[model samples]
Target chain A: MTEEGQSEIFQKMWSRKGFRAELRAASAIAIKQWKVELSYPLSVLWFIIMPFIWFIPYLIAGTALTGSSESIHLQDLTGISDWLSYIAIGTAFTGLALSLLWGSGFALRREQNVGTLETLMTTPMNRETLVWGSTLHNLQHGGLGVILQLGASVLIFGVSLNVWGILPALAIIGLSIIAMQGVIFAVVCIVLTAKQGWMIVEFLSSILMLVAPMTYPIAVLPPILQYVSVASPLTWTVEGFRGFLMYGLAYEGVITAVIALIILDVIFVIVGTLLFRATERLVRQRGALSQF
Target chain B: MTETIQEPSTKSVESDMAYLTDFKPRIMDWSAARVFATKNLKIAIRYPANFLVWGVLPILWFAPFILMATAIAGPSTSTHFTNISGFDDFVQFSVIGWFVFMYLDNSIWGIGNNFRWEQFSGTLEPLFTAPVPRISILLGAAFSDSIQGTLQAIIMLIFAMFLFGVEYAITAIFPTVLILLIMVFALYGFGFMVAGLILVFKDPSVLTQLIAESTYMLSPIQYPVQALPKSVQAIAYVIPTTIGIITVREIAINGTMSLPAFVQSIGALGFLALIFWGLGMLSFKWAEKWTKERGHMGGF
Candidate 1:
């Protein structure tokens, strides 16, 4: 095709000229994922139950250490007296962080394993549609999983949460989710380029969990490590989520976290898209795109 | 022409199995197990990555908790931990659990996954058909995993001693070993049970993961069993590791084992191991027959 024709096509597909097709492409990918995942009903159930699995370690730790969830010393460190509720909220949010870390990248890899990656890559669809679809699929499962995890933790374990803070917490979480999308795109770029295995996934997830106070309160980390935590969007998300929903801290305190998350969102979108696009172009040039 | 092409492979396999079956063992059947143990050790040495991660990842897993405990209690640490655990050090308390947790993980998840890994690599069937007693292969696998895990555990223990200032006692080693032998025997049975289930179900990844997480809760790996609810502690008591861990912790911290507790735990561990190993053998036999009837042994 001529250069002019290529420009016109790109504009049409990405810009307002071809918005409808882009939406349709994304929706189709999401539907395909939903169908494929739901076929493995056991796997779906496992994911839904995953947060409960994640919670047990900390729950046991709290019980074993203090013989109760409330820790006066921990409260001095983190401003939360009830460790159970705090951990419940933290685990709920960490699910989002982990799903974003693992889900987006694995979607592409899973396709390659099933012999659909080549077709998906070569199809006449906007590239953004794939990212959008992956995000949609992860959020569908991850969001529902978090809600159920938190709900069960509350009902069964009696984790006391400030129910009224739901809307404000969700808005802050929205910013965090957008930031995570960028972060996941960058991760997918590495996956596509390096062809590393699950250990790399483990390394990445572990690093993110370490930097973020997802389970452990960030206050407990040394000042240097606490400073480093700011590098991850999850740190902001966890702080904001806890401050709003669990601690019932004033919204003013959480505003700082919200602002920090939005800044991360912007940086991640810019850097992540560039990194992803660069990796995509390199793979196309090298024709490694066809190989898993 | 077809018979000529197929005859050699059929004869070769028959001869191999016949050789394995014909070999007579002395009263001590240690030589057969030695053969497998050596094979397992070679594999561990050659592709140490699978085994090395067990050593490395536990330190990484344990580090955060240690840091957190230090942060929470600071210089003096949790009085509750010292009072309940009989040790004033929270850092040592959690690290002890982490170390025990690593050993249990190596036995249960590591050895159990060996079954799944063999299937995925298309080696399970041939191994099963080998004329050697199937028990030898499992015994060898369990032994190798434990040896590899022991190396990791030592490294972790040293790291914990240095990093957390844990009091290392030479005298505790003898008793710790005594506890570990019984503990490992029971864990091998648990591993065999998992391997048997995977043979039947073909996918116990989720089930194993659940067991892994639940075991952390039920085993008192990170917390004392007494701290849990009475009902939960009752459940925890049934798990062999829970008893083994409590016994070892007592020995390690206080330099003495509770005699009655040790005896009770050892007896329980022996009974559980025998029951689980028996069930594992039966399950394998049933699964082998079922798969042969269906011709799905080779179809992972």
Candidate 2:
């Protein structure tokens, strides 16, 4: 056999080994982050306790105030008698939206700050596997807090899952979250390029929560601002969740939401991946990885 | 002989005068404060892209809500608050409330997170070692945050007005601005306390998500405080942002403010500000002492 042909075969053999090594390293990093989160049980507790604290007042207030009013009209337009259920769903989804943003956007920065980014990069690990591992770790750690909060919602708000196809609604919400991974990735890239730490991301995430229709429906927003909310993933997620939980998941609107989720996920992931790869190269050239 | 004796006394008096001049300005250390603030400001603005991302992104953040609101409720539709005191216009109410919130969140987080970045850049120790007081360093950071936040709020308000067709009364603008300023300072004081905690705990990010989520829920950003139950309303009354939101709503929408409400709002804000400032200063001093003792002043 020719030397060139033999070398090509050897390269292919090494690539397989490299891929396996990368996968292992990424998993290790993800587990490490998860362990760190578990170490702080109080943080998890706060996440659980906060939602209950927020919703109880609304539940009590709704019951008391709506008693005098005709038919428990909590909102101006919509006649939602079950204000607890309405706010409970809103709060749950809002918590979910927050978990996605915080988990993905700051996950990379956290690893980088802890001096793990360079270690992982130097290994035979591929960036995609590392991202997946980090994302998975984020889901596990953040998911624990979210589940705890959900449990609190059930306990405090007395939320009853009566709607059919609730699981599919949750599945859609999960997909929408996964799609938001792209935006989170984009935010991480910006964080890397700016190197100003996580304050910018923190501010952006909070502002997004307020601007998005997480608590109140978009019917409450004015004309132009309503158009703006449509651009956010949170709106789709919230609307999709509410549509399924409140109005039986049989609406055609769910299809539009599913399609939009897929499109947004593809767009965000592709663009975010490209931006991240380019930023990684820039960081490498600047030798910033070691410095941080 | 008398003239010759007068010369020494005159020379002594001149030296004393010079000494007093030097001591007088130390009363405030305004120059040191300015330099400290300017350095941080330059760092924040050094990266134009970052400045735009941090400073201008909040406006874009409002875009999604704008789209959703318009889609659900047509542009011509107005939101009415029957339970609240004087906020008939939903768009205007949301705009002002969000503006205040955006400003508070920016300034508070900016001040609180300054230490983490300083640690990353290997500058925290030097900053701590500087002759200027720690308060000056914090004040400088807070000032930069205020500048960025104020600019963002103005841009956001303009976008909200034009996009939402929000009508504003100039007469109410001044009082609204006053309430906003009080709320900002009061909130910044709370932010300083958190920043102090960051210095001591070394894990401020742990509280970041919790703080961010709770404040928004607690504040009356989109809805009226009265919409909340009596228990929640009591809690909201204690929160500085509630006062700010209610005052702004009353002035801008109703074109009137009850004297009792105005006094209550200002009084609550003032009390909170004083409490936060006192606690923040104490915590800051303790953190400084602890860091210096442990020799971790420079260690990020």
- The numbered model that scores best in DockQ is 1
Q: Write the residue-wise lDDT of candidate 1 on A129-211 in tens digits.
A: 78778887787778888898889988999877787678778888788878887878877887888776567667777767887
Q: Mind giving the per-residue lDDT tens digits that candidate 1 earns over B53-157?
A: 655566666666555454444543567776766777666666667777677787767666676777878988887776567677777778888888888887777
Q: What local lDDT does model 1 show for residue A220?
A: 67
Give one digit per residue, the lDDT tens place, for model 2 in A38-91: 688767666566656555444433333333322223345454445456556766
Tell me model 2's lDDT, rounded to 2 decimals: 0.67
Candidate 2 — number of clashing residue pairs? 21
Q: Which stretches of candidate 1 lie over 4 Å from their true place?
A: A1-20, A67-69, A247-249, A290-292, B1-37, B49-52, B64-76
DockQ of 1: 0.45
True contacts kept of each: 0.39, 0.04
Candidate 2 residue-wise lDDT, B30-149, digit = tens:
667688678877876776566545545655554543433333333322333333424444556667778778766775577878887787678888877665667777777777778767
Model 2 CAPRI rating: incorrect
